[model samples]
Target: MIDLKSAPELKALEPKLNQFFDLAKTKITAIDAEYDNSKGSPVFTVEGKYTTRGWTEWTEGFRYGISVLHFDATGDESSLKSGRDQTVSKMATHVSHIGVHDHGFNNLSTYGNLRRLMLEGRIPDNEWEKNFYELAIKVSGAVQAARWTERQGGGFIHSFNGPHSLFVDTIRSCRILMVAHRLGHVLMGEGDKPINLLERALQHIESTAKYSVFYGEGRDSYDERGRTTHEAIFNTKDGAYRCPNSQQGYTGFSTWTRGQAWAIVGFAEELELLKEFSDEELAPFGGRSEIEAMMLKAATATADHCIENTPVCGIPYWDTGAPKLHLLGDYMDRPADPYNAYEPVDSSAAAISAQGMLRLGHYLMAKGDSAVAEKYIDAGLKMSDSLFAEPYLSTDPKHHGLILHSIYHEPNGWDHKPESGKAAYGESSMWGDYHAMELAVYLQRLIKKAPYYTFFA
Candidate 1:
């Protein structure tokens, strides 16, 4: 429930967007040396210094993805060259990676974004260049689909945690499937059987809706509509569903904020993609209308939750029920104070979630649901308005992160906590940096009335 009147138009935010992208260039340049390919992708900043993180190795594409996005937004040739060169040099391995479940994140942001630009004619119309990006994306999607854990219903893209685990995060990664499907590619599975990328993507979306999102109808004791679990486990042998679990949250029962945000963006994005197809094109996978309806349900529920849970400034804590929030009595009515040492706020979550909110808002508006769409759209704008201001935007040249107050893994003692009082306010993350820029680009395109920003198109 943000005040729509309070949010500025995209045209008015151009200066801020330009400034942020300029600063983004500086910070990325600062971290170029610390990016170590062997140590997995750079996860998040720790104490204002860039360092390698060993998580899923899924964030490397974002490292280059953000640069490409910056180029698209600012027309900076340096950023464009940087993004293209890195994708060619550092991102090829990710497209063929079979051992991990991050093909969507690694490939989509790098190869997918590159291909999208070329399709839009933002890049030079070179057949060889376009084919190179297309091949990478096609391979990446197939590889992602290859790492599947089949179940009784539609299966899911397995997590990095082996065949038994399906992560809510992978929902966002499913865009790789959408891209490959558009390019007329299929995943080759057992006995060289061809698997439909669209079918797999749709199935994964439905599976995520089932296990990741709660319906408030007592599916379980902890079930509440819009609530999400970070991960869900299943039997690898028979694909029998096991139980709800979390690898990064405080507990299995608590909603990890980022995981919640993933559902918001993933479903909204799919809804947009599905809208492009006619009834016949989508009939093979349950008709475009039904699938779009299901996706809208998932996206709207999560967007509602984010709106309710987020503070007035439209940001959330690392966890919805972070134990320490009781200390700051009546905290939700105002902005999330990331400086609170008792419990750190996750700006990264807000950054990612805001974009999803905007996408859902736009989709809803397109479908003639303006009032509801306005709520989510204003909520998204409130976040963008706040994020561009002091203590959120990283204006410093020496700083390594673009958007500040992103906690990578707080439970494992993974984030940097400046000893007592040393001046640690603005921090950034690779995912946050990438998504925020993507979000900015989305808004910017709308203001210019250009081709709407969509992952599938």
Candidate 2:
């Protein structure tokens, strides 16, 4: 479907991706700085140096995931060993963490990548090691899925905020359940409910589709076809939907670019898993076709917005409706300027969303929409190529982050607003750096003619 034959882009990218891994190993990973693991993978950088900022260890997985990707992309065995060793030494507690709603971000990147590597024959064929990885994934997925809130039709994995909150951010975490379901695992809920994880996955996807994603379908007064809210609040008593809310964005009504990226990545990635499900496996959720249609709709809408909202370089301001962005007239027509003193460009949004666009483009091409698919594919590749170069990439050894200008929480004033005071430039986020590696690895694999990165795989 991707039509990789004679891909000029792939041929051009293969060497650059490998070179990035080489530079990252020395500059980013080799740094002696270590933040409190409790802060979740060092939320952001100050003076281009990382420090702890998050409340939970939500991003530890990304740190570990980048290692796996480094090895996968560059065939650097030390990177692989770094990934395996870190998971063994530090990831056990994350697998069983109960309070936070980030098992997918914590355990999945570590355990999930380990299993995926072995399954791909990149790691040695050791059954004990494989089973260890699998068991960890099974429990991690079940534990994450067990954080449930039931509604009239079904339930969703609740956020750390408890039963009343559903975040677009958690959609990517639902992959923990998707992978667990593929392994034939299920979560045990109260009343001894044998909660089917696949069902819960679909339920959450469907819930996010209805509440978080805007389709200009008049679900609410603010609804626009491609607009998405960061958080969706509901009344716990009856699961009746409440007003839109946001923890990271400027306001409940504004679209957080990272949240939009999550919707794009979550739906696009899950759509691939949806195809792997058997008819019987999806019967509880209106069959595979119905589920596919649901996910496809969500992915499509998000990708459309991603293309429309981003600058020509495929980077976006942290929030589309960020109040001060009016200063940067025609930002969408040209590459975003990080020094505008109006708003910072989120390379993290570009890193995360580019892959989502690529996946969606591939899916559409597979589904007979090549004309539209090419646009998405080109957009994704354009973003990916930009991220691999200067200003975005950390070619400077002084910079501890791979991608720059990533904000952790703009509204909270937690991000380091550089000396300019105009925008939070000269920074990095754990998610941003991790997703940049992920974007590079996604393209790297395609160029190398290797197994595609898939949650189901």
Candidate 3:
């Protein structure tokens, strides 16, 4: 379990957060200066240099979003200019993109962060600029919602794998839909039917909560509470539920730690987003109590599982059931070994999940659940301390990555393996770098008592 006994308070981590932003400013600027955008979106690091991965163009937003977030943290007008200009120049396709389940990841990071900064008065409020960002968000949410698959219970936004596949990662991405709903937008379907974005988002959330997350209720022999299957398969012909599957993990039965992180953060963020909706607005989906219960169940379960399965430092290997994990006997009893010849640790997961844990903790505290909330809050802080320090934080001036040891696709052997080692390590990804910066800014906000950070805000 995560040892919360000595987790550093938010104030204590300010200097380290400051140090991270310093390193980040250098790395972000270098990537912007030297990275060849014509090649494609910079996905991950190869030998400490940024490289492109030819998946979807899912990471382009993070590229610009990092700068927007840096500006939020340090008032770097240059960074803000980069973020704003690139987002305007490069992100229009993403708003209307109908090919992938990453609208939230792509649009929310760039457009959403820019919008949030304007609302917070971190940026000068210009009505035209603000409208541009909000319209992008609204359209992005609707576009994301259009990729839906109906089932007996409800429906979910399908993954790029097609209408039959639902990915757990989309749970976090579902926020675009929620944000659009808040912006009074809807998906206009066939015959000009107005599809409710909030309803679609809620259905997607419920579908994910049901199939993607396991609750230790004997759903299968491998069923364990908080265990997340990366993908959930369905029979599209009749919309019948099929089985669990994985694109990035060891297997459907084993938890991929990053997918688990997505669940933890996705559900926690959704829980907080619910507070923005009035009871009347939420009544059609489910009452606030019911919605909170479902989200809380998933969030806390995954958070608990993370604490139980992760190393003392709170970082986890790429997957819980990576075949070679057994070679390192009782690995969870010690700090994670990114240098281990057997497996690679994913600092990106820790960075993403740390924010989830923190958000969940704060949400619970708002509900007067202090004792239980501290566990998650401290666990998040523990992850922050580990992620902000050596072996994880990249200090090398030549490296374009902000955080080290992020795995993109271990199953496909897509990560950069060291010449001396059998496993891939010492890499950073666009999502990983973006989230690390986001997490750092999140902590800094808490320290300064700034307006609470949220995508909707």
Candidate 4:
């Protein structure tokens, strides 16, 4: 069993963290050579096997941001320049487009990185930086407002249009929105817009809470009102809408481990954002105490579930309730091609959740709830330590991906499969790695800040 109560010493992790960052930088540099900017977006893969080659909208920006964060942590000037240039190039092309639904994902990393650049004094007062920052904030606000759904208690929906489309992934997307709001406040000397955005965000969170509760109950995929109709669908393609002609529900009701991790991290992030608001401002939505309590509940519940279900290595299966491994062949719509059907633990999800738990623990500690906080942080630290020890992380030269054994499809009987040989990594997703890097950076920051805050108080 993964020990939640015991934490590996952080000092031991320094070398591993450095190695991971270096590996990430090397991989990112190699990948950049394949980017075809003339084609308008980054290509999906470098191996040239898959014909679908346009830049995937979100991942490109995410990669740039991750690169920036890695450089910031390591002070690698060349890596920093590469990340900055990539972000600047992408922001120039994509930031103004209103049609894209993933502005939060696309812009947050791009502009958020730029904001960090400005804060770090790496970039001078330049017009390009200024323009990108403004554009990011504007586009993010638009997307958040556009995706707002009344049925889900007022939270942002997953994408622009489509039935059966409420997703837990919005947790990450919403964090971008929060980041935009915070940036606007800090950079533009603005407050009202941030306040309004926070209110909208809180409403959305309440809606998510309500819909998520229903989803937990396992009703129909969506109600007539268009909220999540079921309670048991942990990971869904959409929030509450069901695919029209299929009883199987294209909603993707399987409990995606990363999506769950996103929720745990996202909720903790939202609580932090909300705390920035004054007590009076937060009063109407729910008092600060209530918000804190709700966050604590979510943190504890998800952390417990993650610990209980995570594998011995601290990685989690793609779906918590996935059917037995042997029975996978029986349910395959396609032949059990070893190419597609291999079960693997999602290392990225484990990393992200571990980081989220660490943050949640810090939040709890601030609220004078150290026991639960310690539990959460220790769990995260243990998971990170296990990930550090895995030989598979460095052994497979072809496996450019960070974590192994992630399941892209469990119902189709593809779990714990090697993503190395696959054409596109079988959705051995980019966002997972993005979150993993983010978790590492955040954990490092928290470790530094926590002692000072606790000591001074």
Best by lDDT, which number? Answer: 3
Q: Decide which is better by TM-score, 2 or 3.
A: 3
Task: List model 1 lDDT by residue over 53-93, tens digit each.
Answer: 76667788989999889888888888889889999998888
In order of listing, the candidates' clash counts read 2, 3, 0, 33
Writing each residue's lDDT as its tens digit, candidate 3 over 260-357 gives 99999999999998888899989987789998899999999999999988988888899998999999998988889888889989999999999999
In model 2, where do residues sit more than 4 Å from their true spots?
Answer: 1-8, 32-40
Off by over 4 Å in 1: 1-5, 33-40, 421-425
Range of the 10 consecutive residues with the lowest summed lDDT in candidate 2: 1-10
Q: Which stretches of candidate 3 lie over 4 Å from their true place?
A: none
lDDT per residue as tens, model 2, 75-141 = 7787777778878988888888877778877777788877887888887889999899889989988
Task: Flag the better candidate by TM-score, 3 or 4.
Answer: 3
- What is the per-residue lDDT of model 4 for residues 33-120, given as tens digits with 9 covering 90 to 100? 6544555544222232111233245566766777777765677777778878877665654565444445566676667666656655
Candidate 4: stretches off by over 4 Å: 35-56, 92-101, 120-131, 152-155, 160-164, 183-195, 213-254, 326-342, 391-399, 407-428, 446-457
Q: After superposition, how far is residue 9 of candidate 4 from its true place, in Å?
A: 1.5
**Alpha-carbon lDDT, every model:** 0.82, 0.80, 0.92, 0.55
